[model samples]
Target: MHMLKKIGFYIVAKFVPLLVIMLTTYFFSRWLTPSQYGQYSLVISIASGLSIIAFQWINVTLGRLIPKSSADVKIKIINSGLILYFISSILVLFLCFIFGEFIEDNFKTSSYLIALLAVALGGFELSQRIFNSEERVLAFGIFQGIRGVVFFSFALCFYYTEYIYPGVVYALIASYILLSTPNIYKLLFLRKKDFIPNSIKEIAVFGFPLILTYVLLYVLNSSSKILLTVMLDETYTGYFSLGSDTVQMIIISVMGVVQLAIYPIVIGAYNKNDEDRYNIFSKSNQWVLLILLPVTAGFIGISKGLFYFLLPEEAYLRVIPIVPFLIIANLFVQLKSLIFDYAFHISKKNGKQFLPVFCGAFTSVALNVMLIDGYGLEGSAFSYCIGCFVYMTMSYLIGRKIFKYPSIDVGFLFKVTVSSLLMLLIVIQIPNDSIFQFVISIVVGALSYIALITTMFYPQLKKYINSNN
Candidate 1:
């Protein structure tokens, strides 16, 4: 497939479902009370956090190893991964069972049930990663889209029936079960192989460090919710979660598409010691910033208007102050993932990757604890922005020292930043008193950004367009 077409499919595939899920939550928040929505968010955060600890390393390992492996070795690696997943799943379940009461008290639910669902969801996610590593972009996109559609459809039904939170849980479990089926078949029936102990050990050694890294990163991202739930109440958590989740959906969708599409190419180029690797890495960052910068700015500029359209007035008002901070925080998070983190991966200095995230996570936790008591939800948002800034700064410094990819074009970056800022100024000046104005403002901002980008890089853009054509 042509690289551009592949990237387009990947982006559309990921973006559509993410958009659906975000919209679903937006509607769900309206139907459910703040406390109820907060509980739902808490459930998801806990499940996602646990899943990261249990399954992230496996996911990372597959992405790192599968592209370089022979067909037979790929099968072996998959088998090894399956074995590890089963073992880890069982262990996690046992631990959940052992601490069921503590878990129940903390999340105010059945810990065992949430644990079981998380394991199932983690399995589905791991399968998706496998497909991604194999470069089965269509399959990856299709199954992910299916999960989003099924879950949203079910959740909608539950919302109308007045069983919002429990219904969401059931919908997710069912959707993930359906989504996991194909990957299960691929692993167990068509390409089944005996477990390879040596392969398992190799994957373990390569992946364990990533587990800690991801856990700290998750803490950095999620500690605000946890602190809010602790310091104030679930209602406060709900407000913060709503803002953070909204921004996160946008960030993850864009970053996921870019990372999934480019990671293998980057790795392959580096492995072969191709000089083109530098150009590929540099251009990827440039393109990423070009898209992400304006999107982030636009989100910040229109957040008040957009949230009012999507959420109840009270709920929307509660989050207005923090939305820009969350958007900025998420932007930093995306930058770290795409550029700094990948540098460590390419250099095989995975261990060094953990330190910066650790520092950030520590800062996040400390600041949330201290600030939430005084500043409320806004404090949490500010802490998150600070933590992420620290993480990005540290990662860039460490990554440059360990292994440097090509530097991004400062002149191009300046142009993109200036253009995006101009769009933000234009967007913020638009009256957000109604939905029509809100929509028009977004359209105008986007078109203006595109116009500026074209003017700034017309020759390169024209050449690329002609080549693709």
Candidate 2:
């Protein structure tokens, strides 16, 4: 497939699941109280943190190894990965059971079942990454879309039946199970093979350091919620989570697609020592910033009005103030993790990848501990943004020294920034008292951006767009 078409497919595939989740969250905000929503958010955060700790290295390993392996070697890697996953899943479950009380006390919920579901979710996630590494974009998308559909349908059912919290959890568990079916078939039934010790050792060597990397990232992302839950209450945590989720929706909608689409290509290009690798890397960053900057601005501009329609009035008031900070934080995160961090991965400097995130995570936790008590929600937002900035700066410096990819064009970046600012100016002027007005304002802002980009940078944009064609 053409690179652009592949990216488009991956984007559509990724976008469906995100869109479903977004809709689900919108309805969830309306139906559940802040406290109820907070509990659910806590469950999700804990589950995600635990899952990442347990299985993310395996995912990262597969992502690195699969694309570069031969057909026979790929099967061996898959078999080895399955063995590792089984062992890791068992260990994780046992640890969770041991620490069940501590988790329950900290998050203020029964966590044993959630932990079990998290192991399953981790397996499904690992499966998704394997598919991604193999360039099975369509299959990956289908699995994600199915999971989204199932979760949304079951969540709605549970809500109407008045079993909201348990319903959501059950829905997630069910979707994960369904998603894992194809993976099970691929590993156990279709390509059944013995576990190779050498393969296991190789994957472990490559993947183990990534455990620390992912754990630090989890801390950077989730420490705010954990701290808020401890310092104040689940209600505040809920508000904070809503703010993060709002920005995350934007990140996944664009950055997530780009990251997924480009990573394998970048890996292949590096492996073959392709001359155009720098061009691909630079263009990816340029396009990502071009779309991401304006979207972030529009979201910040429309946050109050958007939340007014999407969230309960009380929840809206609590969350709206923190949205812009969270948006900025996520922007830094996307640029750091999705764009600049590629250099580290491609260069096989996996250990070097640890420092920037560790610093950010440390900064985030320290600031959250010191600031949340005095400044409350705003403090968490501020701490997060500062940490993200620290991470991005470090990653950019390190990436430049190590790989030396071409920088994004100054003229192009200026044009994108100016166009986005113009869009923001027009968007902020539209009265957003109602949903219709909000929708129209977003459309106008987007069209204005498109118009400006087309007029101002038409030649460059046209050449870049046609390059892959």
Candidate 3:
């Protein structure tokens, strides 16, 4: 029942908002030109990417610190993070003014736009980090939903009013305000005793690697835009950004469900020194692969049709060839994030596990620099995908060395990979004649995956299921 409530709550809280954003995006894209939409995406991405420095390790610290921290210390940590963020925001604002016009001239992201994004981003981290620590994940989820609605509502007004740029900017700024609303209550009501800040240094030390990891992740993930801006134009950047946002909405909405549940549970077990419960996480590695593999395969299989069907015709025509590779890269990227969170937040690997992430980030930058000149956004996509693979592999190796967990069943992974490939082949054969066919193909592919897992891989999962039962 608890599980059901959690799943239900999160589904509504997370996916509902995501759907709102997706729907809004669909309509917004229709109303706005591709270049206009892409410009919005670029600004947001750049703002988000740049704000990484301001956040430092606060998000990571909250997850680990909250479980172990007393209330007083938590408050201090929150306050300090907030204080630090504001300071960073001011510095970013100054930098933006200095280079904002240059970027606007080159990248189509204006100075005013950069400054607004910087402010929104700074406030966003504080609110988001706080909710994350309290495990009021429902609130966190609702925050995202509200932000989307508010922003979309604002955007709608602006788009219709013919103030395209300002409307969009207002929407972003408004979302940040709305998202930060709940945090005010948190700030006012939560007591000094209910939070902890004494462990600031340790928290920072512990979160250092994750800070580096996530920053690189931002760079790695957003490189497509950066490359697009350089290789193509703001117009092309807009297109890639739209598709990328849609993909992210899908991937994050799905992945967020698992992560929200996994974190509190893992932390609870760790706090209690429950090895058995801690070991439950090992099973997650398998479960995530089982779930993600076929989804990735399906996306890759139906790349052309899916792109055409979901996005605008312009995007559909331009983005088809690149979507599959991008989705594939995104899948691995999602998994790597999961692992990083589990290692840093749940398993309490201190800061050491971040070594791979650093290496992966460095590799990603090098790859992007080398590849983007030759291949453009496609090159960036390939680099990111490869980067995710490298990061996941390294995280696994480092995690094992630190935690000494047993290896996952390689045989099972191989079998699932094979099953996914087979299912993909079958899915590809189905002629996409209509919506019905698409729906049927999806159902068939899903069932095929289930059948393969249950029939061929049942023994492996059965043990885990029975154990839990």
Q: Cα RMSD (Å) per model?
A: 2.8, 3.0, 3.8
Predicted candidate 2 versus true structure: per-residue lDDT over 260-355, tens digit per residue: 767766777776544688777776777678777887888877877877876877888888888888989988987776678778877888888788
* Cα-based lDDT for every prediction: 0.83, 0.81, 0.70
Count of residue pairs whose backbone atoms collide, per candidate = 0, 0, 14
lDDT (tens digit, per residue) of candidate 3 on 1-469: 4644665666666776767766776776677787787777777886787667556466666666666667766667676555445556678778778775566465444666767776777677678667766777787877787788888888888876768875787788878967766555555565556534555566567656666656776776677677677767777777777667777777777767766656666566555454675566666666667767887897777666555566788777766666776787788677766654465445566566557667667677778788877887677667777877787778877766656453568888898899999899989998775767887888888888778777776786689789998
- TM-score of decoy 3: 0.83
- Tens digits of per-residue lDDT, candidate 1, 14-95, equal 8667777668767777877889878888888888889999988888887788888889888778878877887888998888
Q: Is candidate 1 or 3 superior in lDDT?
A: 1
TM-score, each model? 0.91, 0.90, 0.83
Of candidates 3 and 2, the better by lDDT = 2
Candidate 2 weakest ten by summed lDDT: 186-195
Model 1 residue 455 lDDT?
A: 88
> Which candidate has the highest lDDT of all?
1
Q: Candidate 1 lDDT (Cα, whole model)? A: 0.83
User: How well does candidate 1 score on lDDT at residue 287?
Assistant: 62
Ranking by TM-score: 1, 2, 3
